[model samples]
Target: MNIGTAATQTGLPVKTIRYYEEIGLVTPDRRANGYRDFSEACVEQLRLLAQARHLGFSLEECRRLLSLSADEGRASRDVRALAQQNLEAVREKIASLSALEAQLQRLIAQCHGDDAPDCAILDDLMGQRGN
Candidate 1:
């Protein structure tokens, strides 16, 4: 098949598929006419990459995962550890966002939004309120 067929099979954009190839993720064979000839294995690899990206895996992480997936003697624990690390990072981001929400709510509450020029939100942002 061609790159378009591979992109359709994987549900990835043609540009993304090209970028993956540029990044050494998937390598389709080149025909004598200098066109990319995608194999079934290449399409399968693209599908796996799509799934991994949907799960929020970085490209480098996906590369490691693809390597481990190809290893016949790979341990399940290794995959679990990587997933755990990603989970922890997600949790940390959630906590940080929650804190940011709270701070924004506090600032908004302090602002009266009236015709008066005394804006508490600006004061808070300018360090006049000492954060």
Candidate 2:
């Protein structure tokens, strides 16, 4: 199959598939005319990559996970560790976003949202001490 068919099968854009190829993720062969020739294995790899990316795995992590998946002798401990690391990163992001949400709520609550020109949100944004 061609890149278009592979993209359709994997639910990834053509540009994304090309980028993955550039990043050494999936390596589809080239035809005599220089067109990319995607094999069944390549399409399967793309599908796995799509799922991994959807699950928030970075490209580097995907590469590592893909390697682990291909290795029949790979220990489950390594996969578990990687998943745990990603989960920790997600937790940190959630905490940071929650803090930001709380701060925004406070700022919004302070704003009167009336016809007056005075705006607490603007004051806070402009580094003013109080409004």
Candidate 3:
């Protein structure tokens, strides 16, 4: 199959597939005409990459995961460790976002949102008012 068919199978964009190729992630064989020829196994790898990316794995992390996925003797503990690290990062981001949301809520409540030019949010952002 071609790149288009692989993209359709993986539900990924053609550009993303090209980028993956550029980054040495997926190496689809090139025909004599210099066009990419994706095989069934290559398409399966592309699907795996798409799922990994959807799960928030970075490209480098995805590379490692792919390597481990291909290694028949790989331990499951290695994959679990990576997932745990990602979960902790997600938790920290959620906490940070929660704090930001609280501050934004406070600022919005303080704002009059009327014709008057006295904006509480502006004052808070400019350090003119206490947080």
Candidate 4:
């Protein structure tokens, strides 16, 4: 198959596939006419990459995961550690976003959306709170 068929099979954009190729993620063979020729295994790898990206794995992480998947003698503990690390980072982001949401709610509650020129949101943004 070709790159288009591979993209369709993997649910990734053509540009994303090209970028993955550029970053040495998936190496599809090239024909004599310079067209990329994707094999069934290459398409399967692309699908795995798409799922990994959807699960919030970075490209570097995806590379490592792919390597582990290809390694028949690899231990499952390594994969578990990587997943745990990613989960921790996601938890931290959720906490940070929750705090931001609370702060924004407070600022919004303080703002009286009337004809008044003084805005609490603007004041908070300008570091002039409690003024």
What is the descending TM-score order? 4, 3, 2, 1
For 55-107, candidate 3 gives per-residue lDDT tens digits of 88889988988898889999999999988887887898899999999999999
Off by over 4 Å in 3: none
**In model 1, which regions exceed 4 Å deviation?**
none
Cα lDDT of candidate 1 equals 0.91
Shift in Å, residue 38, candidate 3: 1.0
Instruction: Assess each prediction's global lDDT (C-alpha) against the native.
Output: 0.91, 0.92, 0.93, 0.92
Per-residue CA lDDT of model 2 for 44-100, tens digit only, reads 899989998887889999999989988999999999998898899889989999999
**Candidate 1 lowest-lDDT run of ten:** 81-90
Q: Which candidate model has the greater lDDT, 3 or 4?
A: 3
Positional deviation of residue 33's Cα in model 4 after best superposition, in angstroms: 1.3
Stretches of candidate 2 off by over 4 Å are none
By TM-score, the better pick of 1 and 4 is 4
Best by TM-score: 4
Candidate 2 whole-model C-alpha lDDT, 0 to 1: 0.92
TM-score of each candidate?
0.87, 0.94, 0.94, 0.95
**For model 1, how does the per-residue alpha-carbon lDDT over 35-88 read when each residue is reduced to its tens digit?**
999999889889989998888888998898888888889999988987888788
User: Residues 1-131, candidate 4, lDDT per residue (tens digit)?
Assistant: 89998989889999999999999999999999999999998888899999988988889999999898889999999999889888898899899999999998999999999999999999989989863
Stretches of candidate 4 off by over 4 Å are none
Q: Which ten residues in a row have the lowest lDDT in candidate 3?
A: 81-90
- Two-way lDDT contest, 1 vs 4, winner: 4
